[model samples]
Target: MNFLTLPERTSGRRTYGLTSVIDLGTPIRELENILSDYSHIIDIAKLGVGSAYVTPNIKKKIEVYKEYGVKPYLGGTLFEKCYYQNKIPEYRTYLQDLGIEWVEVSNGTLDIPLDERLTAISQLKRDFHVIAEVGSKDSDKEMPISEWKEEIKVLLEAGCEYVITEGRDSGSVGIYEKNGNIKSDLVHEVMKDVDEQKIIFEAPTPKQQMYFIKEMGPNVNLGNVKLNDVLVLEAQRCGLRSETFYLGERECRLLL
Candidate 1:
């Protein structure tokens, strides 16, 4: 358990290199166990799409996360669902009741107008800390890189706390191909125009995560991480695992 030699990591808070884990209705006992062991590394627990509405004791779930110092919020898809159903006002009021502060605004599934969606970002920012998602969820409906960059700029300017590069939980949409390969060219161009620190790359796969960690350093914000992979991610970030083991001291040795 001694990680004194490990690569340094910031405490789990609203900080850089943040790890956002998806709370997929894990049993309370199991959830407690995991949190007890790793909550320090977990920044946010996103109640997966529509889960906050259906999970038993949903409010208690949020309390459990907070008790462990892990912030919780509903997924962006759920926000889109409420917005499409004409219940955004009701939903927004209910968020405070649920004790979650991080709000996600996305148009990945619905046909929301670009101006209206970005305007919503501005409106929502007035009340909540928003994480705006930029990119279509449909793999076939790819947006041009130039347009994506502009959208991210507009969202950030609209008061979004961070821009989520839509790589859905499946790792098959948004910034990734259907096979989970990253579109490096598109990502590089977007990063050139946007602040790398303000981005939370949707990296569901190990390779995808490593790609960003290697490119942006270990603390680059990453999201849609499965609940169980929190520690594994810490390992990769510290080069304690194979994928990034070379990152540990290879350069130091080379310099020597």
Candidate 2:
């Protein structure tokens, strides 16, 4: 068998595929410039946290991102903040008015009840493609791997397009250790309970990205990617570079 000609390589867009970038504070001009060059390789662009509130030109940014066929949306932390402040209805209206076609529902910061979280997912789905996030931001309050897996099932059943495994922006907590390495045993446990296609791992480092690609393949959905690293990450995903591509190839060879 040709080692590089794996059937898994044929997966299409918006599936369990590669290179989702996080726009933590990407200026609209810079975003436009980058997208003009590399939008085809990027899958999603998240307007991270409350950074979307910083500019009066956010709607214009959303328009440009969408124009390049990139699905842009509010970060989960922003949603959690809105929900906590009882601004959810207003939040939904604002997203709709801004022409945002996707939104994230997460309980990373706040103590939202599961049912309410599910309800928010349902409501968001009526107007936008909803992605839900599991796991807590607080390292001390991390949910067990088993619980996270089960919650993924619940979210998918309730119509969430995908569930993000919380790694926060630092990648030093949640599923990752203080040193930024993933707890592979916990990852293995979660993998047993959900389809990997329905999950996006929040990997913010090159090492973390390489780890997931090596263990879960190139199609593993990754988030919290830095804006400047978008092309670099895409190169890793497509085997365009030797550093990260080496591990990706090893994993693909094993599959073969």
Candidate 3:
């Protein structure tokens, strides 16, 4: 069916308007189905937390994402776990053996100081594309907006391809409040101070997703999206969903 052109979303292995989906040990066949149907919109497939450490047919799953042009990587949580276990050397070797190229260096759960985290990103940069994550997973741990801006800027300088603001898979903590609502002012402040292109906001819920879409336009990078929500997010990106149906309106574009 022919339809009006939707707002132009970045196409072909997008650098923006990216949807980084979480894969929590989806069976190989099921993963294939998702990629076959929505690979065009799926930029990064993260094996959730430490699922990559235990998922069966792990290599095949990574290969499937690559075959469909979707970059796959282990979750930053897994990297934190490896670091906590003092097995980073083995972890790097494991990723290398699997032929994975992208990696997330996060301190969401751990209390690795800023300097050490930057050092890790610099060292990891030698072997893989690094995407660092900021913000604590603990909702009570409030970080000043100025610090958020500073960390994001420095992480980019330290060789991180992008820095993720942590709104976890549960839609609580980090960029969100305890009840899962966005800290809109904080989001705005960060955008004003940092490179929006290199910041991926982890919006795991439909409401949070729409908020980012409306506030940042369709090309704002998003992360921790559920596998099933890929097409839904794409629909919203193109103004196909009711929540953002007016996105194609000239008034909306003017706001951006």
Candidate 4:
């Protein structure tokens, strides 16, 4: 047996493994091809932002994604938009009608009060798997680490299956600095209070992905991955193509 194969490769469909692609505007056929070839390695595909609104065959798209064993959900921003327009109940019903089992609850763009957010979480839990996001879209509106930690606990208590750290599409705002890098100390503090298994780090950059895999290990849950980077990110997690192999070896040496 090869020593390289000593550790069984981490499987997909894992809540804390591999890539979660964000589908901005890929043609349905192209999306199907990509998922068919790489679905075993891609955990989730998010119809990024409001892309779901423009897709004519939303049900067909969801069915194709589900056929490949990939979980698909509308972006958090879309959910916020629905909530702001006072169409949340309709939104929830519409998604249910579309056969969507997962939904993202976030207030990145809107100022949803805590009570209302909790209510949404509680109600959505009855019909769907809820993934709530913590953090704001505005770069200047930084959420205090203490507040983030508290909110994570509250959301989890209110029935959220996973809590995502906001990184927008650019990964420059939210938990990251203006330079598009994760604030390691802040991540460390957040991890201290929240269960890493239930926390999805929105790491869109390779450097940020490497940082999280190095700092939090390969099994750390990552989100907002670009559609093209699914295979690359999976390779990183498996130590097949990334600096993570060296990092893991160094960690082993340190332990020894």
The prediction achieving the highest TM-score against the true structure is 3
Q: Write the per-residue lDDT of candidate 1 for residues 134-245, one digit (tens) a residue.
A: 8888989989998899989988888888888998888999888999999999999999978888898889778888998878777889998988998999889887788787
- Residues 47-157, model 4: lDDT tens digits: 999889888788899999999998999998889888878899899888988889999999899888888899888888998999999999899897888988898899988
Error of 2 at 216 (Å): 1.2
Give TM per candidate.
0.93, 0.90, 0.96, 0.93
Instruction: Please give the TM-score that candidate 1 achieves against the real structure.
Output: 0.93
In order, what lDDT does every prediction score?
Answer: 0.85, 0.82, 0.90, 0.84
Ranking by lDDT: 3, 1, 4, 2
Lowest-scoring 10 consecutive residues by lDDT in candidate 4? 1-10
In terms of lDDT, model 4 sits at 0.84
For candidate 2, the per-residue lDDT at 131 reads: 90
Positional deviation of 210 in candidate 3, in angstroms?
0.5
Name the weakest run of 10 consecutive residues (lDDT summed) in model 3.
247-256
Pick by TM-score: 3 or 4, better one: 3
Off by over 4 Å in 1: 1-6, 12-14, 248-256
Of models 1 and 3, which has the larger TM-score?
Answer: 3
The C-alpha stretches of model 2 lying farther than 4 A from their native spots are 1-12, 240-256
Overlapping backbone residue pairs in candidate 1 total: 1
Error of 1 at 144 (Å): 0.2
